[model samples]
Target: MIPEELLLKYTAETKRFQKDEIIFSEKQTAHYYYQIVSGVVKMNNFNDDGKEFIQGVFYKNQSFGEPPLFIDVKYPANAVAISDSTVLALSKSNLFKLLQDNPETHLKITQSLAKRLYYKAIIASEISSQEPAHRVLRFIDYLKDDVYKVEGKYSFKVAYTRQQMADILGLRVETVIRVIKSLEKKGDVKISKRKVYR
Candidate 1:
């Protein structure tokens, strides 16, 4: 984890949010770089038809809001708390000052940006080159790795609803349900309320 002193030097404020609370709206000015200290945050994009699509989900210890901050643009998506969450907020000026003061931190930030770009590339490739089922499978695989624990049986707690899952995978709700059913039929996964066993 990044050192607390470094974070404190850059951060100007801190905020807490409850589950399902909106952190920011699409087109909102990017004033601060936010770091999640605990819980989860979901970033989503909406279409003109009022359909929402999830862009990404951030877990504990993750940072966001940098891209738009660097670009000096409005936030491209809306961000919401998936659970009770706390975030460190660094204003744009503070971020710039930190980067200027710590060259090493600037390098680290650049590397982080590069990694994010790579992930976006991977997602784009998967969307164009892989079948919808395979894309969903890949997403499931990611969730399994990120959120599950394995013992005698695989069990996981999901942070989002089925509809949210569908949005995250860029699939229709029916298609998401179908894939879940398929996984259940194959004995690869079992859903019990909010828990999934695989």
Candidate 2:
């Protein structure tokens, strides 16, 4: 991710968005490079039958929707705030110049996008071949791996709700609930005071 000082230098302002607010819609022209300053955001899309699919969730200090900005293409998915959120939005042109001036920051962006692509590849096979419980465990394990990279720790609270997990994994909310309880029973996951840890 780019540094906050550098992002603000390009945007000149921070904007607030409420929960469930659409930040951008699918097929819209990509115009801004966004970084979440506070709260959560989800990149998602709907299928032809109106089923919702979550591409990814981002937290504070995380950036989303970068590929379109770099390639000058329409957004393929919508971004929406999952909670009351503040975001810094940099103009695409300004962001490009910032990247040009800072090769290290550009490298960070490249690595970030590559990481997401790797996650997508794993998830594609998981969803296509795994059972609900298997898929759910794989998802949590994937997140655990990411946390391990950052903190060198194994346990972390899940940032998403059951419904959100269901949406992302192409399962029913009931299925997610059942799988979570099953995981708890199997000692694969721990749910303490309603917060999940793995």
- Show where candidate 1 strays beyond 4 Å: 142-161, 184-198
Compose the digit string of candidate 1's lDDT tens values, residues 39-147.
Answer: 8998988888989888888887777757999988899898999899998887789888988998887898888778667667766777778866677666665556633
Task: Tell me the TM-score of each prediction against the true structure.
Answer: 0.78, 0.94
What lDDT score goes with residue 54 in model 2? Answer: 94
Estimate candidate 2's alpha-carbon lDDT, on a 0 to 1 scale. 0.88
Candidate 2 per-residue C-alpha lDDT over 35-130 given as tens digits, one digit per residue, 9 for 90 to 100: 999999999998899989999999988999989997889999999998999999998899999999999999999988988998999889999999
> After TM-score superposition, what is the CA distance of residue 125 in candidate 2 from its true location, in Å?
0.7
Clash number for every model? Answer: 0, 0
